[model samples]
Target: MSHASTAVQERPTPPGGPGAPESGLSSRSLPRLAPVGFAAVAIVLAVGLGLAAGWHSKVQWGMIAALFFLAISYAVTSVVENRRQAKDRLATSIVWVCFLIAVIPLVSLLWTTVSRGAERLDGYFLTHSMAGVLGSEASGGVYHALIGTLEQVGIATVISAPLGLLTAVYLVEYGKGSLAKAVTFFVDVMTGIPSIVAGLFILSIMLIFEIQPSGLMGALALTILMMPVVVRSTEEMLKLVPNELREASLALGIPKWRTILKVVLPTAIGGITTGVMLAIARIAGETAPIILLVFGSQLINANPFSGAQSSLPFYIYEQYKIGEAASYDRAWAAALVLIAFVMILNLVARGIARWKAPKTGR
Candidate 1:
């Protein structure tokens, strides 16, 4: 043979005959059924162990299954592929496990509420009040509590929204020196103040002035609790509004206050509205303030500024306290109503967000 042919013959074959590693690392991958198979095995093992050990808690069994799934997945992936791919799979598995863990409680709570509360939820339940119904009877409705919640939350929103928005604007646009820092610090501190503490603060003021318990007092306490949340959310939203928008407005000979009112506020309006709604929802379900300030009543009191009022949360608490079957049913129904109210508010907020979002195409 010629010299070129001899050289070609002398050259050794590539690791796997051609264009491949000898260890087959590049070609290796976990089988498509790996996750499902591992999960099934883990579940079976966990169930068997739980039964053998006489553990009745499904939570414990679930934890064991999750742990087993993670371990078996990592081991199999590491053996079939490599350490790097194994770690990736392990992280993904961990994320899924955590998601399930977080979602389980929420699902359970919703299911329990819906199942137990649907029995008493009807037209009469939504329209009438608990004015003359006994706790042991199932004739009362949540209309009074609903009215109280709406009025109190509305008043609190009206008070907090403007204050929170203006405060946020100041912090973002013009605040400086010690005053700004002090405001920010206090706002942070107020964010963590308990609902009962807010109620107590308002109650103290009421006591000094010899004021009576009423829905207005509850609204005041709610305002104190809600302002910080609004401030924080609005401040963050304002921060997210690009500096370019403000600069462009200023470049057009606009005054600072006018620019803020005309440009900045409109730009962040969706987020501000959503924040205000969330704050309203939060205060709507507070029982402590209602109990302390409004002094829950069975009769409907349309005037928030004068007499004792009934709120959904306080009504739920009062009914549950009775510890009778009928009372329990009312409590669950009221809870379901509160949840639905909050959900509606959230849905409205999202709708507002979509509606007010800046038009990009036009």
Candidate 2:
């Protein structure tokens, strides 16, 4: 053979699989189907072990399966690839397992709620007041509770949303030194305060003034619980707005307040709306404050400012406390309504956010 041919034969294209990875990258890795195959094996082994060991709980079965999957993934990857690859596979496995652990329970709870709640959820149960929903009879509905929740929540939103938005703006735009720090410290403290504390705070004022139980009282308690969340969430959203936008607006000789109103507020409107909705959701389910302030009336009190009223949370608690078969149905139905109300708020927030979001890529 010629000299050129000899050199070509000597080199022979350094042997390895096609398109092998370079340094600082993986050379060999697990196949895409490897996880699925490993999961199947793990399930089989776990089930066999569980049955043999006389385990009755499905939770134990799931735990054993997760353990087997992790072990199998690491061992197989280490043998097939390398220790580094095995470690990566192990971490990924751990994350998937943890995600399943969180999601499975949520799915189960939603399933239970939907199934149980549907039994008593209907137009009749919605439009009629529970004025006479007595024992062993399904004559009453959640109309009264719905009215109280709407009136109380609306009043609270009107009271708290603006205060939260302005406070967030001050903290981000002009707040400094001792005042800002003090405000932040108080907000943080309020964020951690229990719902009962807010109720008691309002209750003390009520007692001092001889004020009667009313939806207005519940709104006041909810306002305290809501403002801090609004402040924190709105502050984070405001901080996310690039300083360049503000600077550019201010360079045109616009006043700081005007620039904030025209530029900053619009930009962060979506997040602020979401934050407000979250705060509303938080207080919407609070039974303690309502119990203390509104006092849970069975009769529909449309005028929230004067008379006692009932809310979805309060209604659920009262029904569940009855412990009758019909009461249980009404309780589940009220729980479902509460969930749906929160979901609608979230949807509205998302819609508002999308519509008001700053346009880009013109």
Candidate 3:
């Protein structure tokens, strides 16, 4: 035979095949059914263990199944592929499990609230008030509480929004040195203060001044609770506004304050408004502050500055405390209304955000 032909015949094959690598790893992926298959096996095992052990809780069984799924997935992937791939799959499974765990309670709460509250929600329940209706009677409404909530929240927002915005502006735009740090520290401290603490703080002030319990007093406590939230949120939003926008305005010979007013604020206004609304929503359902300051009233009181007032949350608590079937129904109904109110506020804030978002030509 010729030398060239002999050389060709003596040449060795690749490790696996003609195009295969020397490494044992394959380019092919696991079957798409792998997760489903593992889940099925886990479910079977979990169910068997639960039945055999007489475990009554489905939650326990599901948790066991989830653990099995994670373990089996990691094991099979490690055996079939490599440790790195196995770790990635395990991490993904863990993330999904955590997400499911977090979402389950939220979904359950919404479901329970909606199902129970829908029974007594009606026009009569909304437009009328508990002014003359007895707690044990089935004829009361939440109108007074609704009015009080709106007025108090409105007053609180008015009091806090501007102060918070100005504070945020100072922090983001021109704040410096020890003063700025002190303000920032206090804002952080205030943010973590409990609602009850805020209520008590206001109650102390009220006691010192001999002030009466009224919607305005509740609003003052709410303002104190809300300002820190607004400051934090608005400060973050202001920080998000590109510095280039401010520089551009400055280059045009605009004053620093004007630049902030016309450019910086407009840029972050959507977020600021949303934050303010969220703050309002946060305070809207506070019962402690209302109880301490507003001193819940069964009768309607339109004036916030004088006389005891009613709020949706306080009204719910009062009705629930009555422990009667009618009161329970009213409480649930009021809760539904309050939830709807907050939901509406959120929807409106979202709508405003979309509407006011900076226009960019696509």
Estimate the Cα RMSD of every predicted model relative to the unseen true structure: 3.2, 3.7, 3.4
Task: Write one digit per residue (lDDT tens) for candidate 1, span 1-362.
Answer: 69999999898866545555434554578788889999999999999999999999999999999999999999988887767788889999999899999999999999999999999999999998888888889798999998999999989998998999889989999899999999999999999999999999999999999999999999999999999999999999999999999999999999989988888888888898899888888888889989999998888889999999999999999999999999999899999999999999999998988898777796
lDDT (C-alpha) at residue 285 in model 3? 90
> Candidate 1: how many backbone clashes?
0
The digit string of per-residue lDDT tens for model 3 on 1-362 reads 69999999889866556565423555545897898899899999999999999998999998999999999999998877667778888999899789888999999888888888899999999898887788799998999999999999999999999999999999999999999999999999999888999899989999999998999989988998999999999999999999999999999999999999889988898999899989988998999999998988878889999999999999999999999999999999899899999999999998988898777788
Most lDDT-accurate candidate: 2
Sorted by lDDT (best first), the order is: 2, 1, 3
User: Is candidate 2 or 3 superior in TM-score?
Assistant: 2
Over 1-362, each residue of candidate 2 has an lDDT whose tens digit, in order, gives 69989898776444364444332244567779999999999999989999999998989999999999999999998877867788888999999999999999998888898999999999999998877658567678899999999999999999999999999999999999999999999999999999999999999999999999999999999999999999999999999999999999999999999999999999999999999999999989989999999998878899988989999999999998888999899989999999999999999999999999999969
Model 2 pairs whose backbones collide: none
Per-model TM-score on C-alpha atoms:
0.92, 0.92, 0.90
> Each model's C-alpha lDDT?
0.91, 0.92, 0.91
The CA lDDT at 55 in model 3 is 100
Residue 308 lDDT (model 2):
90
